[model samples]
Target chain A: MPERRSQRSIGGLTRRQVLGAALGAAALGAVGFRPRTAGAAQPPIRIGFCVPLTGPYGSEAQDQVRCAQLAVREFNASGGLNGRKAELLVRDSKLSPDEAATRTLELIENEHVDFVAGSLSASVQLAVNNITKQHRILYNSISQSDAINEPKDFSRYTFHEALNPTMTTDAVGRYAFPRFGKRVVFLLPDYAYGHEMTRGFKRVGKEFGIEVLSEIRHPLGTTDFSVFFPRIRALKPDVLVCCNFGRDQQITLKQATDFGLKRAMKIVYPILLYTARLAVGPRAYQGVVGGTSYYWGLEKTVPAAKQFNDRYRAAYGGRVPSDYGAFGYAGVRTILASVRQAGSVETDAVIRRMEALHYDFYKGPEYYRACDHQAVQSVLIVESKPAPADNQFDVFKILEVYGPNRVHLRSCRELGYS
Target chain B: MAALTPELLALQLLVGLALGAIYVLLAFGLSLIFGMLTVVNFAHGAFYMLGAYVAFAVAGLTGNFWLCLACAPVVLGLIGYGVERFLVSPLYGRGIDYPLLLTFGLSYVLVEAVRIIFGKQGYPFDSPAALAGSVEILGNYFPLYRLFVVAATGTIVLALWLFVEWTNFGLIIRAGARDPEILRVLGIDVGRVWRLVFALGTAIAAMAGVLAAPLQGVTPEMGDSMLIESFVVTVVGGMGSLGGAVLAGLLVGLVVSLTSVVAPELAKLSIYALMAAVLLIRPQGLFGRAGLLG
Candidate 1:
């Protein structure tokens, strides 16, 4: 009797009619209606990271991605710019300029990344900068390049997180010139990066009254440094400044040691990579003094550095981040921080926030120069440890910490900025 | 610029000879394989790289450079044997292209496998303690390891010459190289001869890899440039000619070293120029027999 009554009308409607109406409302709710919550309403912020993931710097690129991922994770955990989570879309730049441009375009046009970051090679970074500039997307370059800061290439959207060649060479030269000697010789790889490094060194050398003995331009990827060894030894300079990078740096340093050039002259690199030091081992790299953007040894004095290192170690199998890897973390973190400060992902708002923001995210206090958008940061003068330490990562001993004010970066006017 | 002193000139000459020794070892293997199998081993560089990786692994485990040197060749020889039997044997009589393609593909597979196992980073392999530092020579310092390399290559060359010229197995190899049909008619197992020749060639390449590892660290792509350079040496020395490989390797080394002094940019190009000039004059190569591949 109850079932029959239910099957009959409820007021003016049957039970089946009432049930159908409720089901239709539920389906509509499932399809369209939703609560406007901060976390649920907004999509994740996408950052396109293009790096040399398939070339000589592939290992470094892998470390960069790992550090960037840590940055994104940290951002999301910290409420994520008003409850909008962050995500990363990585693409292999292939250490080629054209390839980097193509990948950056894809990131902008198809993937619709809110911000762009990464590139290890100087030329490749410039190429990425051009693409991001055209699209009006914010780009944070995490590579050492003088060209990226030049007025010809600089744009409002471009932010260089890594130190330029000028800053690095200045730090190294200031520390090394008076100590090592006045006479310097350069073995440069024939490329833009090498050329820029040599230029920076020469600029710094002029200030210290150092004599440049000779500049030998070797082909990129020259495995045999034997032919150049005799030429270098004959020069007998007080310091041999090798302006090569990655595999070139490793081979040249190893061969230089083998040829006994280290016996006569001091070997100084503008920037000695942590990964390169690890790859070449202590014997080849030891006693070689150079400038670095970040050394995890800063953890002893800098609390921020200790925090970053601890988080990184916990995430990456107890391995500390390399100098280049730190750049990746800083690049992504700064971009997201700017978004949080601006309270929106709008390009202009983020740009304004970044320009005004002074941060000590990893190493120490750093601020973007308004004219060129270059990160003015501290450079550490470090020497390769003479022997392997208990911790393999403890390869470099910090000789001096040159703060941003001590490190001479090129002025905007000097860079042709009006 | 530093003056090209007589002492520096003499030192450069020694460097050229040292560089040539590596090319000769690599080219000799390529020539031997081509001589016996009539198949261009495009994977020669991969075998060389694997040899270095194997040497690195052995050296890491045992801490003995000499032991690593010995083990690399043995490991590579076994690998070469397996590759010939399972992968390459079926492609026989299908023309040179098939094996060449197969080996090319094999080279990529091997490189990828190494990349996956070892990672893309290069690892340093220190020279033996005895050869760690440089010795003063010709009024300049030269790495003791380079001198050791030259001496080692000379000894290897002499032993290889003796084995090929004096032994019965060498006779069978020579017969197989010239005419497998005749070797088959004489009741010899030509397939076994081919397999042995391939193994010997790969082992020699592996030895060269071990020798070069200390000079340049071991990496997955370490064999890439060596492969191209060795191919140039093989072609310039004349295809399938061991003596030609030796002579042409030294010649190419001298040309590259001397060119580097004047124009470092053109140093790599000088080798190709030498090849093109030689081909224009004699298409068969310096020691290659006429109409072999044609």
Candidate 2:
């Protein structure tokens, strides 16, 4: 009995504990609820997409996915990164922040993907930050939330390939100030993206001797633009700047046009140039000027862009893919650069390689902001052309290109990167 | 403050009307279902989303908008009927908790199923060639599609109102709600009426969805906001009162419009705020009866 008692204990683990475990196990009879993991050596190049694939911003995700796939295909065709054919194991965040974290785990554990790509919505980007950070895997955010760059939340393994609101604001101000001039009233989305946009525009506007009379914020997913419309119409500012995203952009613009604000005042913003064209169609948005990083029909002097656009239009039923498509494709290029330099599918090495990246794939100056991993690319200041002849995706006339320096980008190091 | 110039006010009104039309349709079915079932139907908006997706998928297959519209309600109604008989029927004698939980779970399941099946990406559904652009209305150019939606919704409300008053099935459904045990004792099969009520409610939601397809980008989450608003309308319009529902639907629409005209940010929010305000004044709601609560 004494010897049997001693047999029950084994170092830190008790035989009593083991016996307890064994009995408990016997009653339960092995639940067999083991979780699966992405196995052995062939670690897939996992790319996390935290976009609004199902929610209000779903259309944006659809366009983004197209760009991402195109970029990977292009990279693979060109012998991939370090001569290993690149693969993008995609996962959708469905636009909810909580869901973004939950879905990302599926990729991280099940597929054991190397890195994550941020989806279109900024809200989703905010959610994916720490979850991806804990894993120490790279999460490249295409979502335009500045929170990703702020000190409290910034991740070393994270990078942003899309425009921050500040970058967008500055680029638009640079392109529009000299031509359109800037006595502006900013109508922004009522969330963090709105704050970022309004601040960025105001900052750039001040630098360019422009005056902003008022900046108003509206809640996201507002179907009616009436309240803000009446106020903006009253302001009659020189540039009636709209800083909303996705369907909000469409609804706001359409309501603005209906309220005769377009006739009452001039209007400009990044989304006005792209999404508006689709929502209200070309007729309503015709002659509306705005700024964006890229346009489908910018007629790029750069051979790379030209080739990409041509191929993209061909594959996508001849309808032009928007700048959303370009950003997605460009994201692929950025990822390839990192993968090539890292010379492996390892996440840490890929992130290090991303930090050193400065690729020139455009006719104009473009650079990724080292501070926030934001791409400092050219913004096209465009005008809507005249008549039925130029009406087919010919919605905008090129006013100017705000190059990398014109926007005056800051990198992660400038943001006190360690 | 922006001055309310004639052009500005007129434009705001036009925009308000365009927005209000959609709100009316969203609230309509929820109101209709509440008028029949004492139990609130939370699954109405999910049906709305399903309708849009079905329309989109059907349109993708046949490239016909009319066919998609015609078929969506049938498919969704059948689905709604299935839920009523299986999940909702067992809980009929129980308290509201059972049906509420059941419908709420159903909403999540349906949303996730769509995500899993469609992979959460937006599928491109072409706008109807007929309703592509705007026409000059009320001294402003409004999208022709928006006008069509408003008109079609108006027609649907009127038809439903007429049918409920005149049709035998509608009368029997109304009678059952008044005395469900009597309905069962009379050998009228109250369960069948409950199932039919659910199917019809889902059909109405889908009707709104099909109409909305060309106007807004079809998305999986589209039905959610509508669902909340409809519940508000259902409560405010006095449960089981069809006429009250119509009034509440129009009221919500006007409230949304008026609020939007002055403050767009508060447009979607004003309905709930209005509901809260009304609930404070009259615990039963603006048109709801104390008798309906038991």
Candidate 3:
């Protein structure tokens, strides 16, 4: 009845009541509002890169650093993780385990970084892993050591961005042994990684019906390999596998060329570095079969990789990106993506999000396995070939790509990783 | 174990001789420096690295491997002259440890400096086109570059021996090694002689570096193993005898090379074993004078 009095009238409604309703609405609007000003309230996410910037691995470290910087730059340019800018703080590990530990701890305790990356040497990475694990900081290792993924060395916070020795050996050995010959000789560096690599090749090689005729574990950083060359020559194996790295790899390969080892049999490198190949020369490296995680020439086939290579060349004054650089770039990208997916930067949250994550950054479909934290991706079996006159970085032609399921070990459970 | 075939033995012997030649170059320089200065220049290895880097740079700029070889020793010799005059002159009266410590510190500085300049990656100066291939000898294939290395080293050692044995400068250097104080009293500038000998020793080490440039790619730390090997040569050969150093270099090289064929793990230890054997039998070494043993 009173409805007829005034359907549109604010009967008994006070001015203060209306004002209170408007005020509540305004407060709700303010609560939901986002300023879109580059995450003004949150601090920059910092990543500590503990690399050998001034030691035996300094140049390789520098290349990795450049790639990492490119990754950070791209990430920041595209409205960084959760709209927060990313920062990379580089510290030189100096190729010493103690120094690597010291620098890693400094980054964790002093600099308060969210994650850590970049160590070319396995020893340095292992040293850093201990520190990062204690602090529960995520460590993305660029070093290729199977020891890194061993149950005894495994940590939930650690992830290997690069291939392990087993992966490398599997990727290269399967292809090399069948084509070259079954009788292979090894020149391993006398260190943990070198030993693991030998074990890796032997473990995988046995499945391929390959026999290791002999192996020489030379001291790390040997200046002259002339002594071993004659031994290798005399052994007259069907394949000569070199497991040395850094300067040792360069010297051994050059001396191998000098000794005409290639003339006698196939000279295969399980883990070949671009810098080493360049030092050994294209003429020598040609016809050499090896496995690398990535090469810039693949940019032609992979659009994402091409994008990365284009930007990298533009930024680096036309210097092509090496596999080491790719590892560093992908490593940072993987960590940041985990943070994006988890919607938080908490170490446990991001690590949980990272496990079993399927992502691709330039390279083909890659995933960080939940078990061992090893990045499972396509291993590119490349044969070093002469580059076209127009291009210097086109040193390799990708012969085949092996999926993670094929090359990666299923022994994580046995190694104690849950 | 497989029996060594004749071909294998010949190849091993050739490699042993090549390895010995490099050791000789390194050890001879250490012997000269130790004899005249009474101060072991641990930095001698650093000088060798400088020579390699300089040669690499020269080869890169000029595209002439021979020019790199020719210029490296000269540049390093001049550097050694300056280093001896400025750094080593004041420490002559001090104990041998002072100069040794100075050179040790210098080694660190030089290695770090080279790392800063050239980086950790090695730069390859490929063996010249003429020497890139192998040569067949007695059913075994030997790298021509290696054969060249052996020949060059042999010639240099012979020339060095003749100079030390025949030249007046060599006589003064030999005399200075025995008694610098007596030489000073004999109206000879013992300090100048020491400086010249130090420079010569450094030049020889540099020459070894230049030769090694193609054999082993040039890296900042390339000389580290060489330094240790040279020390072993000095100890195994008499402390200050050039001919003893040569003999020990060849002996160590052979032992290391042959052992590596059958037992690689023992290759490094074999050199120390030889050193121990020498120490136990003849403290003065194969060609060392008994007086120098003191």
Candidate 4:
């Protein structure tokens, strides 16, 4: 063994004592330190997007996917949620409820997504809602299913980012009944969305003393509507309320023109999609009055909306985003805002912030109510005028913008929110 | 509810016939292929869908609807020939199930391939300007395009009937379908006849597709309902009977149209109901030969 070294001392403290003091201070520093402290690096917060990506609505789903991506890109470009970059996980729902639920769970359990958004059909949304409620993942639906926010379907973790059928009827019916006359015929798709629209229209019709001449429910993917036209024409209703969209709307409108139904009655789609108008051509939609939840023209009137539209069009091959796109962008943006406001990615904290938040998306100002998670936004009542000579997409001229006070359903407390 | 006036009834009848016209075209192809090849050709609807897409492309590029009508069938006929030679011909010696399974798989592949290429979004194809607008018929305003559909389909049907009943090659095809071995022993190349029959059947389906594209809008899934509906039409009319296909197509169309006025929900189910009723009454179908595929 080597000779033992003498103990060193400083300021009347032994060497061992000094070392013990230093090590104690390091222990204190390690125990007290936090990785999620302010201004520190953070892991990415992920959002799961479950939407129809292979069926008839696949093209519309692209709008949601692109806009959702755009929102994340913009948020990350602006330093993300408190300096933590926002990440998006997109899964194809295949327009199947089973697939939507499976993909949603995969996103939540496997991908560990903090939130989920996107759906066009009611069935898919309901399926996703069940899974999200069970898992307690925050789900913001862009679908306009009326039952989604009702007491029977209510969930604390779910919020609707788009307008419901009730609001659509109140807005479109209130506008059309007086101007277009009260005798109406409904050509609706035979499904929940169509049924909800029919119910809403009937309610508003009853309120306005409008007579429903007839209600014809056609199969969802009907390629022909001539069989129903003879009945519609025989009744000679003042207005034909078309509660259909996508290819159905396009096909029916084209055939309506063929059958000369336009000559005797005014044609209207209670809710018109931008793709439908474009697909059918402006000539088919000219002089038609309808309701749209969002339009790119609103960007010209609203500064914040204009900014978002400008950036979106620039990134998406100069293609203007539809209301569906606006809803998707709004969903992601609102979720991110909630995350930032709460200063944490915890579901409850974000829910609290989202409930109280008011923000402008690619439309006017909007907010989510605390009780039902219904976003209070303006409904666009529009007329499809001949597109101006300078612009190709300027098919609609906004007639009026109905605020949430004018169009929204009763408060969540009254609606029996869970 | 108002009374059903004579004009209304007449108009509804005409509309039913117009719709039936398309069914006739679709069912005719299905009947011919089954009659001649004994192959179900489940991909018949997929070929129809491809024809519509071809028409859409040709019309878009050429800005001529007539060109699409002319070219789509020809293009589909060539594709049919290739399909029969490479994919369907080898399974000829095997049981009917083999070709049926092959066609079913081919249908899935075609539909998915279409989805990959053109996407699920529907492409807009406008009716020709000449066919646009309505014309007064029997004191009722009817779509001129619908009248064209009826006329065109009628002409095609007549031509098909003539070919089957009048032509020497048609006799060979009919004989081959009835007894391929007899035709083979008679020194008539039944294989060549089979290929021709398959091409003709696909061509007819394609023709229907081109005609219906503007009305229905081209979609990858458009072929799905068409296939099922055609099957219903085939079974009711009697599989392998071209004339029976026409009769059954019209009957089904009339049933659906008339039922819609009374109860719209029964329109689709009515077809199945009719099929079941007919099958229960005559298992071989109204026109299908006895002891044949039911």
Candidate 5:
């Protein structure tokens, strides 16, 4: 028979007694432990990125994520926020406002992110802003929308990194009206973005003695533009201002080219995306002129642009960053810089820091206007190259550059900020 | 609004015909599959999208649009035959819902697989150089490529009519559709006829996709909206009726074009309104026989 073994004792105490003593010491140590201070072993700061990772804008959204990733990498390489590295938590907005809200709530409530940024659709960004506003989280909107800058959608935490439709229209109208006649017809997608673009064009048109021939509003994502071609041709306008985005823009441009509408009127898209141009190919987009937030061609003049393009190309398989993608880079870069400048991720501190920041990150001089938190930045008027160039990224030729100024922006009083 | 002149009206009618041609190509395929197999193919659109991608690949390799056009239908037809034989044929004895559900799942799988193989970004497919420019018609400029589409659709319609109405194989197809058990008793392989019908349907859809590639760039989701619209076309034309599909396609296109002239926002909604109207008046559809579904 095996002998019965008693519990081993240590230091003249029974095993249970020693274990209880050790547990008590551990409890005491746990109670005494405190989190490390800033600059110590702190957790990485999280920025919840909400964008349309699916739907028609999937490619553009992927590019945005790539640009944001580059921004995060640069931030961490430069010792992000006092040695606390920055991290991105990405969630698909799905290009739907309701989906964006749900995903954003998950990001804040479950993931516990410090800030939120992203959105390609104007309406979708507004949805995200509403959620971020209620939660008191700083949100840098990277999509173009004039409605978001109005008092109805404005908040202390809201900062628009992209140029609003008003700014884009002003730049395009001022440049194109003098070059391509003042008689214009507007083919706009029926949405907040389209309506805002029309408002801006009409406002700018008044200054150029523009005769508004007709304004054709089609449903968003209209694949067949054949029905509207007859009407547009009947109007016979000198300039056709197409205010559509993503797939809508691509289809409209291609169909319009097929119908030979480009032969009659000079087509001017308010915001011509680099991705859209690539999707439509040289033949469809050839000779089309529009305003862009950023173009790789700007690297020829701006040192910062050159640096950004070089870094982006080196990291992303030699493909230049797109215009919408550049907004992602600028938004994340500026927000992270604000966090560093404030020395904290506190909402109020970051807001204050962002408000005072005069940044020349990827593009030329840019600053957030105090009234509406809209970024005042340069708008590049670019014309699509008529033929395929040696460098594929050389899709556009910079016709003119409108420098950063409030001249194109609505006044503080107009924004109901007085 | 621009004044609607006689010339403008004529031009709009031509445009409607061109638009209807695409809808007919898509709807006929759906109608054929439903008529022969009684399977509501939710993957019809996916097949269409696959056709466009295949065409894009073929064109890239050979740099010939005509060759790609010929290759897309053959490739899609083979794929359809395999799918029908392996995936769909086994579920014939089961309720129709089984095949319907299976096809619905298959659609998503195909779209995702395409996305994986070809990046999410769309690729441009320019029209052939011969059809690149617009021709002046009725005192207005109209796309020559669109005219070609109309002519091609008319030819397909006539060919399909002759094949279905006059050919011995077509008589067997009709006989099998009416009573497959009777046809089986006569030593005919009804299953083979159904598989061929399914393959033919998918091939037609793929052909439509090849034609549409230039009008809209090739993308994974290109067939999604087209599929939904074509379903409405199939139902309004009388499900399983080729003649009905052609008529309904044109009618829907006309309604959309006319509504767009008055209220552009209602263009898309107009087609659904037409479907609802048709369903309310004649539930079996314009050309459908009553008690067919019952």
Candidate 6:
């Protein structure tokens, strides 16, 4: 018993051993930070945001949530809308159309959200569009659906904040026409967005004296793109444009490289924005030019853009401004301006304010277009630049900027909008 | 009549191989599960997602991609084995509907678990830096990463094929599948063999996930879409035949791709239609052993 007690005694303690144990504890303590409590508020205004909270577009969904929250935060800090506090009501649609429709009803009835917002998934957006129309409530849709602006699908209640596919490609066609020499091969996704975008590309491509050589629609999630490559290779167009979003965009670009499509012909991506950049490093995305709503370094041209960039960076702890985030941030700004114009949270008043008025939205050209209640914002044409260090969204040189007036849309009647 | 360059063909074939590889892995699991137990294992897709997430965490901690890839199957195999031992073993002599119900429930639970853990965001995993660039063939640029996917899947399939056909354990597994009770009469433990087969099948599915983590977007609900497709392949290939699965996988890939040139919306549903056609013609599947590819 005496020997056992002696053996248990600390006889050979080393400075290194003692230091190691102390360091381990210190490291764990350093990692654990104290959280702050949120201050209580009274009668907060609820703004419902229905996005793909659990699907392929979850990242974009999160951005939408943050932007809405940030706007609500700023609104409250700056004495809120009409001196009333604002709180966002977020519901995940899981990127399903039916679910989005259900969530829209829930948000409208159960959550009692004063205003409704668009989701990340275009399908969800369409669902919300129908639901919001039935309710005759305001729908500030960020869906890439031109149907929102189309007199046929457009409602007295629905207003679009983002660019339509036609609007997006209209600018690209105008800016890249002369430089790109317009021999185009369309590699569009085989879906509604793809079809609309293809139609838009061809419409503008033809106007700019660009020949539409050949068109091939690739399925949204096709793993092997080999079949499409042969067609593109055969055509050898001056510009090969791939109009696919999300993972499809990244995969297309990577696969295009492997097929040597770049060497044969100059490749043009209609849009290579945020989500694609994060999945594929900036270094891998070099030599590509695409359009965007805004960029952080683009403050000098827009004047009021710098404030947005600075505030957004501050809020997100200096995370770079992604297209989705900017869309969210600017969307909130648009809604705020409209809400101010409306003077009250009367849904009809807000819709009228959005539909009738045109204001200088600092994001891009013409700010907001009264023609369709869609932003006639500036689209930045940037070329990707390879980086020395790997970073998400580290790409592109700003090639050209196209404003809304320059990138005009054929009236709702022309587009069968009615 | 058609312009198909060497580089173009290479790229297309590489794409085919990559898709085929995924099919091989997917089909192998489907085949083995159906072969040994006569159950489709609809939850196989969930297991695949688990393997990917597991690889992701392990890779992040150790910065060892190969190690993550190697060990994912082992962990998944153990999990599959456990599932068989407890949840599945009781239903072994019972009706097939019971296991089907159990697996369907298990799939939902697995998906919900992933949702809880990963927070529904598409977790992006970068491909290994060693093979990230594009490879050119016939003036068409294709990703080397896809090529690597092809190589890896081919190797795994070949190894699996060899293991099942040549190895003594493989013989026992096959024999056990044919008549599990008879193997018991021969002093062999049929339960252990069944467990091994189940684990082996699941391990293949898990390895498929490890390969896909970099290539495909990872999400909690990713399994929902893939489960249906894997079933389509299994049904098309005639359930229990490994070769049938690979062939049907390529055929399905081509159909999906080529159809995009015409009708995009029905590109997915075409597989079901094909399965219907096959069922109407050869109900046992082209390779399944007389309705055994259940």
lDDT of all predictions = 0.85, 0.67, 0.79, 0.81, 0.85, 0.70
CAPRI-style quality class for the chain A–B interface of candidate 4: acceptable
Superior candidate under DockQ, 3 versus 5: 5
**Which candidate, 3 or 6, would have the higher TM-score against the true structure?**
3
In terms of lDDT, which candidate is strongest?
Answer: 1
Better of 1 and 3 by lDDT: 1
lDDT tens digits, residue span A215-245, model 2: 7767887654554655565676878888887
What candidate 5 gets wrong by more than 4 Å, as runs, is A1-40, A387-389
Better of 1 and 5 by DockQ: 5
| DockQ of the candidate models in sequence | 0.32, 0.25, 0.25, 0.29, 0.35, 0.33
Query: What tens-digit string does per-residue lDDT give for candidate 1 at B1-294?
Result: 778888877787888899899999999999999988988999999999999999999999999999988999999999999999898999999998999999999999999888666765567788999889789896677899999999998888888888888899998888888899989999999999899889989999999999999888787888998999999999999999999999988888888887777777788999999999999998979999887775
After superposition, the stretches of candidate 1 with alpha carbons farther than 4 Å from their true spots are A1-41, A387-390
Write down the worst ten-residue block by lDDT for model 2 chain B: B118-127
Give one digit per residue, the lDDT tens place, for model 4 in B156-219: 9999889888999888887888789988899998888888888998999899999988787898
Reference-based TM-score of each model:
0.91, 0.80, 0.90, 0.92, 0.92, 0.87
Each model: TM-score of chain B?
Answer: 0.98, 0.91, 0.96, 0.97, 0.98, 0.93
Tens digit per residue, CA lDDT, model 3, B1-294: 335878777778778988888889989999998877877889999999999899888988998988887898899989999999999889977778888899999999999788656655556678877888888776556789988988899999999889988999889988888788889999998888888888888889999998888887787777887899889998888878888889888888889889988888788889988888988898777666676423
True-structure Cα RMSD, model 1: 10.9
For the record, the alpha-carbon RMSD of candidate 5 to the native fold, in angstroms, is 10.7
| Interface RMSD against the true structure, candidate 5 | 11.8
> Candidate 5's residue-wise lDDT over A1-418, tens digit each?
0000111111222223323332332243335422233455787787888787666776677678778867887898898887887866667677899999997887788767899998889899999999999999999999999888888999988999999988899999999998999888999988888999989999998999999988889877677898998888888899999999888888888888878888889999898878888867777788899999999889888999999998887775577889998999999999999999999999999999999999988889999999889999999999887544567777889998999863388888988898
Which ten contiguous residues of candidate 2 chain A have the minimum total lDDT?
A3-12
Relative to the unseen true structure, what is the C-alpha lDDT of residue A222 in candidate 1, on a scale of 0 to 100? 72
lDDT tens readout by residue for model 6, B81-188 = 999999988997677888889999999999877766665665666677787777655545566877888788778878988998999998998897788888889999
Question: What lDDT is reached at residue A298 by model 6?
Answer: 75
Error of 5 at B272 (Å): 1.2
